[model samples]
Target: MLPGTLRAALAALVPLVALAVVPPAAAAPAPEPVAPSAAPVAPAAPVTWTMQPSSAEGPDGRVSLRHVLDPGASVADHVTVANLGEAPATFLVHVGDGTVSPAGDFDVLPVDEGPRDGGAWVTLGDVEGAERLGPGSLRVSVPAASAVTVPLTIAVPADARPGDHPAGVVAELVDAGPSRVRFAARVGVRVHLRVAGEVTARLVADDVRARWQPSWNPFSPGTVRVTYALVNSGDVRLGARGTVSASGPFGAGATHRDADRREVLPGGSAQEVVDLPAWPLLRTGVRVHVAPTVVGEDAVDARLEATAVEVTAWTPPWSQLALLALVAALLVAVRALRRRAARRVQARIDAAVVAATTPPARPAPPASSPPAPRPSSPPAAPRPDVVPRVTEP
Candidate 1:
C-alpha cells in the first residue's frame, strides 16, 4: 500500500499480459483464401499429320503407298485412303502450286495430261477439306478400328517445264476426340517430265570389282557365286542376256543368271546373280572373261557387250579322294592274287599222295631160292636102308 509508483507499474504490466493472452482471437486476419490461379489449365496445341505412299497398292492391314501424279497436272484428283490409325480421325489431302485451279480451294482445274517436269499438287481431301489435287491420285480416310481408300485423280497442264520436279505430300495424323495414338504418313513426290525432250541411253556400272560368292573355289563339284550390275542406257527398258566366263584347268565356261530382261528401265540399275557349276572347265585358276550375247532376244535395240568378272576356282578335293580310292583298291587286288597263287601250290601238294609215299620199283629176283624144296624127300628112303644093315651086325 506504501509504494504508489510500484502499483502504477504493476497496473501497466497487468494490461500488457492480458492483451498478450486474449487479443489473438480478434478476427484471425481474415484467412487468405488460395487464389484459383495456382492451377491454371493449359490449352491444347493443334495436331498435324503427313502421308507417305508406297510404290504399289496393298490390301487391308498392309500400308498402300503407291500414288502417281503428273508434274503439270491441274485437275482435282483423289487417292485411295487407308486407315492405319488406332482411333477415328477425319483426314483430308490437298494439292498446291499450279495444280490448284480457280474453281475453288479444292476445285477442279482443267489441265493437260502427262507430267510438265514442274511438280504438281494431289490432296487427300484437305487439312480439313482441300481441293485441286494432282492427277492419277486420290485421297483416303481411315475410320476408328476401320479403313477406307478413295481414288484421287487430277490433270497436268500442257505447257510445263521439262526435267524433274519435286513436291511434298503431307498426311495429317489427328484424334477427332482425342485418343491414344496419332499416325501420319507423308510422301515425297517426284515428277519426271519426259526428261525435257529426250535423253540418250546411258551406261552405269556397279559392283565392278568382281567377287566370287564363296570368294574362292575348287574344281570339285560345287557352285560358283557371281554377282554383277546392269544399267539401262536406252530410253526403253532393256532385257538381254549377258555372260561371265571362267578359265581354269577345267576349261572356259560361263553362265548368265538373270539379264535384267523384260523390265530394265532406262537409267535404272539391276543386280545380276548367277550360280555356276564348278565342274571341269577350260583352264585352272579361274580367269575373267565376258560374252554379251549367249542366247535370247535383246530386250532393247542396242547390242550389249559382255561385262567381265573376276573369278576364283578351288582345287578338287573330290578328285584326290577318287585317286586315293583307286590306289587302295589296286593294292587289295594284288594282295589277293598273291594269296591265291600260294593256295594253288599247297592244293597240288595235298593231292599228289602217290609221289610222296610209294618206294622206287626194282627188277624181279628170279628163282634164286627155288632149289631147296626137293632135298627134303630123300631122307625117308635112306633111313629104311640103314635099319637093315644094323640087324646083320
Candidate 2:
C-alpha cells in the first residue's frame, strides 16, 4: 500500500494531470476532447461507447437527432449507449448546452457551467439533475459487449426564442481509482432543437475592415486582408454566405472573394478573415454581404426566412499610391530639366545662325569725298577769256 503522504500527493496531481491531457476551454475541461466520430473513445482506454440518435430498428443506424417544437412543446426521444469493453462498465450520462469554438468546432458547456439554453430543456429518465451533471449525474452499468437504450425528453419553454438551439447528450466514462483522476471519455450525438414560430434567420456584418499589404515591386500585385464580425441578430443558428467585393473608384478593376462557411449560434457572433491577392489601386471600395442560412431540418422555410446584412469599408493604397506619385514627380522634374536645357541650346544656335547670315558694315566712304571737280567746264571758259586779256597786255 502507498504511504498516506504519497497518496495525498497523487490525489493533488490528478486534476492537473487530467487537465494537461485535455484540450483547454473557457471552463472546466474533460480529461479529453469528446470525439464526434461514430465510436468516439478515450485514447488507450479500454472502455468504448457509442451514442447515436434513437432508431426503431436499432440506435446504431439513426441518421441524426433533431426536433422542431412549438413553444411549451415537449418531445420524447432516446439515445443509445453501448459498452464495447470486455468487462462490465459504468458510464455517466450528461446533457449540456452547446457552443462553437473560435476554431469553428462545436462544443458543449463545461462541466462547471450549467445549461442556460436547450441543454437545460433536456431531461433523462435515469438522471436526477437535468442541467450540469454533478454528484447527481446518472450512472448506468452495461455488461460486456452489451448496449442499453436510454430515454430522454426535451421540452421547449413557452418563452423559448424561435430558432436553433444546439445541445449534446454525452456518455462519459469516469475513473474510480484511488487517484480520483477526473478522466472522462465521451461519445454522443448532437441535438438540434428549434423552437417554432417565426424563426428569424438573419445575420449582420459588423466592424468590417480591410488592410492592404503592398508588394515591394510597385508594378506587381499585393494582398488585401478583409476581416469582419458576423453577428446572429436573429433567433437561430446559421452559416454565413455571400461574397466580399473590392473595387477601385468608378468600378475599375473589380475583384471579389467568397466567404467561408462557418456556423454561428443564435445571439452569438464569430469573426471571419479572408485574404485576397489584388492589385493595389489608389482607392478601393470594400463591401461584405453575409446572408444567413438555416441548417438542419428546421430550414424548411429557410429560403423565404433568411435575411442578409451588408457593410462597406473604403481604404486607400497608400504605399502603391505614394510610389506612383513619386514616379510622376520624377518624370515632371526630368521633363522640366530637359525643356530648360533645350531652351539654352536653342538660344546658342539662334545666335550662331544670325552671326553667320548678317552682312559686315560697308567700309565707311572717304570721310569727305574730295569736292568733285566743281567747275571743270566753267574753269575752261574763264581760262579762254583770261588768255585773250594777257595777249592784249
Candidate 3:
C-alpha cells in the first residue's frame, strides 16, 4: 500500500504529462474582413438673391425702368431686393452709370467708382442704418426670405445732354465672413432715361478693312475676311444689321454674307468682322453695309440711315498661277524639242536627197585605148556611094 500524499502527487503528474504530450488543437487564422470605401460627400449649395424694378405697392410687372423726361426734371421710382437665403443678408444698393460692354451686354460702373452721368443724378430714400457709400449709393440689410422696397429719385441735371443717359440700380450682396479672396454677387435692373431733345439715329462705319486668305488647294476658292467698326454717333441707342459682300474685278464671282444684328449705345462703337467665300481673283472688292434700327421696344421718331463702306483686297491665285506656269513651261519645252527633232529630220532628208541626185564619177577605164589621129574638118563629109566603093576597095 502507497502513502496518501505520494498517490495524490502521482495523480497530478499524470495529468500534467498528458497535457504536455498533447496540446490543444491549433486554430487557423480567419481572413481579415474588408471594409467598403466611403462615398464622396457633396458640397453645400450657395445662397442666392434677386433684384428687380418695383413700385411702392409691390413688384410691378416691369422688366426695367424707362422714362422720357426733360432736362432738370425729377422722377420717382422704386426697386425691390429679395433675400432667398435662410439667413439674413446685408446688401449694397447703389446707382451706377450704365454703358454697353464690348460683349454687347448692359453693364454698370463698379461700386468703388463714382457715377457721373444719369447715375449721379439719382438719390436713395433714407432708411435706418443706411450708410451713404458715395453718390447715389447706400447699404441696407434685409431679413431672411424677405423683400425690401427702396425709393429712388432721378433728377436730371439742367445742362444734361439730350439723348439717352443710361443708368442702373444695382444691389450687391455683402459677404458673410472675411476671406482671403473676396467676391460679391450683384444683381441689377437697367434704367433707360432719355432726355427730351432732338434725337438722331446715325451709324458710321470706320476703319473698314478686308483680308484675303488663300486656299492651299489650287482648285478651291479662298476666304475673304472683312472687318469694320460700327459707331453710334447719334443721340439714341441703335441696333444694326449689315451685309458683307465680296466680288472680283468687274463684279465677278460675287458672294454675299449677312452679319448678325448688334446693338450699340450712344457714343459707343462695336467692332465687326465677317468672312465670305471668294474666288481667287487678282483683285477683290469687299463691301460692308450697316443699317441702323431702333433698339428694344423704343419708338424713336427719326430717320435711321444705312451706311456702306467698300475696301479692296489683293487675292492672287498663287497656286493656280504656279501650276499654270509649270504647264506652260512644259509645253514650251516640248514644242522646242519637237522643233529640234523636225530640224534634224529635215537635215537628214536633205543629205539623203543630195546623195541620191549626185552622179558618181566615171570609173577609169581598165585599159587605155590607142587614140586615132584627128582628121581635118573638110574630110569629114563623104557620099554614100563613095563610102561604099571605098569600103569595097
Candidate 4:
C-alpha cells in the first residue's frame, strides 16, 4: 500500500457524499422558511480497512503480469515498511516458494525440484535471514516505526523448461514479540521464468596417458586407465533406469563384456581400469548399448567404438614415451593432491593438539567467601559478688 493517497482519498469522500444527499429544491416555492418537518440527513460512514497501519509501501504490493522468467531471475519484491503507529507497529513475516495458501504458508511444486533432491523445509524463526535471500524461503520480523527494506527473491534452476509454469511467492506476518497478537497479513508474489533450451557438457580429462604400474599398485594399468577414462567422460548422472553396455577390446569379456549398466546424466561421468583374466580386450567391432535417462534423450542409442588395449612395463626399454608422459603427468597430479591432503591433515592435527594441551579456564570468584569467625577468650572474671559466694557454699 502507498502513502499520501490515503489522506487525499479521505478528503475526496466528503464532497462526493454531500452532493448526493442534498438535491435541488423542488419547484415548490419557499413558504417563509417554515420549520422543517423532516429529520436532518446524517453524514456518510467512514471506510474501514483491515490492517490499516498508519503507513505501508511496496510498489502497491502486486505481482508482475509477464509470464516469462529469465535463467536466474529472482521472483521476490523490494518491500519498504515503515512505522505508522504512534508507538511502534513492526511488520514481521516469512517468505517461501510454491502454491499459495489462503492463510499464507507455502509448499514446493514438483517441477521446481532438482534431479537430485534434498533441502530444508523451514518455518522462519526470527526474520533475520531476510537481510539476505535467494536460495529457498525467508522469514522476517521488523521493529515498529523503524523502516526496513527487504528484497524478496526467487530462483529458477537452469534445467527448467522454457515454457510457462505456475509458481508464486508467499509471505506471512508473524508475531515478533510476546504481544499475543492473533493474525498477521499476507503478501503474494507471482513469477514466470523463461529457461533456455540448452544444456552443456565437455570432456574434462587432460592429455591422455597410459602406463603399467606394479601389479600390487591399486591403480589400473595406464593403457586401461586412459581408454576407460574417455568412455566414462561423457555423463555419469542419469535417471535410475539408464543403461550403458559395451563389448569389444577394453575389459569386455565373453560373459563379462555383455554386462549391462545404468545410463549417466547429461554432463556427469566416471572412469575406471580393471583387471582382465585373458588377452581378449574388448576390441573394435564389439557392440555397445546405451539406454538414456529419458526416453527421447540422445543417450538412448550410444554406439561407441571399442579400441584395442594392451599394457607395457613401466621400466625403460619396455616403457614407451607415450606411457612415460602419462606416468609423469599422473605423478605430478598425485603429488599436488597429496600435498593438499597433507596440509589439511596437518592443520587438523595442530587443532587437535592445541585443544588437548590447553588448560580449562578458571571460574569466577565465589560470592560468599567472607570474614572467618575467630575464637575469643572466655569471660575473664565471673560476676564478682554472687558468683564467688555461691562457689564457696
Candidate 5:
C-alpha cells in the first residue's frame, strides 16, 4: 500500500534485520583460521671419522709404517686424522705394542696398558696444550670436515734386542663429555721395525699324539686321529702347512690327510688335529710333516725347513676276531654232534645185523619123557580096576 521506492527500501531493511537477529550464522567459527599445516621434522645425523697413515702431501696411500734400522737408529713419520662429522672432534694419538692375535690377525695392546719393547722407543709429538697428556701421547682437535696431521718419532736404544719388534701408532676418539655409558673408537697402523742382527726361522712339530678309532662295521676300515703342536722356535714369524700320514707295518694301507695352513708368531704355538681314514692294522704308525714358510708382506732373508715327528697307535680288529672265534666254536660243536650221531647209528646197525644173522635157539627138547610115562601107567591101572565095577553098574 506504500510507494514502490519506500517499499523497496523497507524490504532491504527487513533482510538486514533478519541477518542481525541470526548473528550472521555464527561466522562459521572463522574456519579456525585453517591453522596452516606444520612442516615435517628431519632426523639428526650420526658422527663419523677416519685415521690413516699420511705425509705432508696428505694420505700418500701407505697402509702401514715399516722400518729396518740399526740398534741405535731413529726414524720419523706422520699420521693424519680426519673428522667426517658435523662438529669438531678431539683425538688421542699414541704408540702401542703390537702382537699377533690367536686368530693370526695383527693387534695392538690397550691404550691404558702403555707399550713395551719397540713401542716404548716410539714417541708422539705434542699438539696444542699437549703438556697435559705427558710425553708418549698427544691430544689434538680437528674441525668438522677437516683433518689434522701429527708427527711421531722412533728412537731405538743402543741395548735394544736384535730382532723384529712389532708396534703400531693408534688414534682414539675422545668422548665429548662424561656420560653414564661411554663408547670409544680406535684405529691403528702397524710398525714392523727390524733391528739389525741374526734372523732365524724355525718351525717344529711337538707333542705328536695319535689315536685309532675303530669302526663298528666289520667290513669297513677305521680312522686315525693325529694331534700335534706347531711351534715357532725362531725369532721371526712363520706360516706352515702340513700333512698327516698313517700306515701299518711295512708300509701297508698307507693314507694321508692335509692340514690347513696357519701362521704362528715367534715363541708361539698352535695345536692341530687331523683325521685320516685307514685300514685297521693291529698297529698303526702316524707321522706328521710340517713345511715352514715366511709370513707377512716384508721380505725375509732366512732359510725355511720342513720338520717331522712320529707316533704309534694300537688299532686292533676286535670285531673280526670275535666273528672268527664264534665261527670256529660253531664248527667244532657241529663236528662233535656229527661224530656222536655217527657212533650211535653204527651201534644200532651192529645190533640189528647180529639179531638178523644169529639163528634162533631150537625149542628146548622135552626135558623129561619120564614125566609123561608116569601119568600113562597110572591111568591104565585105574582103568583095569574100574572095568569090573562098571559091569555091575
Candidate 6:
C-alpha cells in the first residue's frame, strides 16, 4: 500500500474535480433537486456531476473556491451537484484540510481522515432544509438528470492562524456494495481561504555546497555541481525561483545556471542541484539564492523575501602544474645531453692537443756482436805450415 501522503496527493489529482465559492451578495435559495435515494442493493448506477458557482450567489459557472476573511468572520457560498444517471444516487459531501505534496502539488486530507485544523471550522447544510448539517460531511440524494445545490459556510475562528489555509469541499458517491472492496468517485473544488492578519514572508538558504568534476583534457573546462536547500519559514507557502553562479579566479570564467521552480510548504525546504561549466582556475566562488514568490497568499499585501549564500573553493591547477613539470623535465634532459656531448668533444680535443704539443719518443741503439777472435787462429795455421817448411830446409 502507498503511504498516506502519496495516496492523498493522488486523490487530489483525480479527474472528478471542480472548485468555486459564491460571493456574499450572491446568497439566495438554491433550486430544489426533486430527487430521492433508491434501495442500497440495486445495480450500480452510473453518475456524473456538474459543479459551478450559483448564479444567484455570484457569477455563472465559477470553478474554484476562493475567499479572504478576518478572524471571527464568516462567508456564505454554494456548490451545485448534478446526477446524470437515470436513477437516484446518493452522495456524501465533505471537506478536508489542504496541503502541498512533496512533488509540489496541491492535495487535501484523505476522505477517511477528518479535518483537524482550519478545515474543521467549515460547516454545511442542505439548501432545502436550511439547517446546519454534518461535521465536515453531509448526505444528499439527487434524481436522474437533475441537480442539487448545497450551501457552504466557512467561519474563521478567533484564533485562526493568519495566511493561506487551503481546503477542499467534496461530493463523494456512497458505495453500497456487498463485498468489502468498494469503489466510489468524488468531485470537489479547492478552497483558497486566508485568515487575514499581518502576514510575513521569508525564504532562507542552507547547506550550500558545490563539487568539481575535472575534465580529462588539460586545456578543456570542467563542470561544477552546485547544490542548496531553500527553506520557507513564513506562515504561508511559497515558490522558489533563482539562479546559481560559479566564477573562477579574476572572474574570468563565470557560469550562471537557472534553478528549477518548486513549491515549498510552510516550514519546509526543497533541495536544488545545478551543473555549471567551470574553468581550470585555482580559486572559485559559488553562490546560490532563494528568491521567494508569494504563493497561496494575497500577493498585493504580502512581501517577497530572498536569501543568498556564497562559498569559496580552491581548484587545483593540475594542468598548469603538469606543464611546468614537463618543461622542467625537458630542461634537465637537454642539460644532461649537452654535458655528455661536451665531455666527448673535450676528450677528442685533449688527444689532438697532446699530439701537436708533445715530442715523438726516441729509438734505443742496437746491441754489438762479439769482436772476432780470428787473429790467433790464423797465426797458428801459418806457423804450422812455416814450421814444416823450415824443418825440410
Q: Which candidate is the best by TM-score?
A: 3
Q: Please, what are the lDDT tens digits per residue for candidate 1 over residues 26-133?
A: 555777888666766665544333343332252333232222334454433233334444544555443332232122111122222333323343334332233334
TM-score of each: 0.36, 0.63, 0.73, 0.24, 0.65, 0.59
RMSD of each: 27.3, 24.3, 18.4, 38.2, 17.6, 26.5
Off by over 4 Å in 6: 1-59, 83-92, 126-134, 138-146, 171-187, 213-221, 260-265, 280-282, 295-297, 300-302, 313-393
* Residue 227 accuracy (lDDT) in model 3: 85
In the range 206-324, model 5's lDDT, one tens digit per residue, is 99999888887778888888888888888776788888999999999999988855577677788888998878889999989999876668566788889888889999998778778
- As for candidate 6, its clashing pairs are 18-189, 19-63, 19-64, 19-189, 20-64, 20-65, 26-57
List model 3 lDDT by residue over 126-180, tens digit each: 7666687765888889888988888899898888888988899999987766577
Best by lDDT: 3
lDDT values for all models = 0.43, 0.75, 0.87, 0.39, 0.81, 0.77
Ranking 3 against 6 by TM-score, winner: 3
Worst 10 residues of 6 by lDDT: 15-24
Q: On lDDT, who's better, 1 or 2?
A: 2
Q: What is the per-residue lDDT of model 4 for residues 1-393, given as tens digits with 9 covering 90 to 100?
A: 548999889888999999999998779776696776888777433221112111125445343323334554434335444444334333333333333232223343332242122112122222343532334444344444455444544455555544323344344444444667665455544333233443322223222243323332223222222224323333222322211222334433322232222433233343433332222232312222332233222232233333333332122222344567788999999999999999999999999999999999999897987799999988777556755335554
Model 5, residue pairs in steric clash: none
C-alpha-based local distance difference test score of model 6: 0.77
Model 4, residue 3: distance off in Å is: 99
Worst 10 residues of 1 by lDDT: 101-110
Clashing pairs in 3: none
What shift in Å separates residue 376 of candidate 6 from its native position after superposition?
37
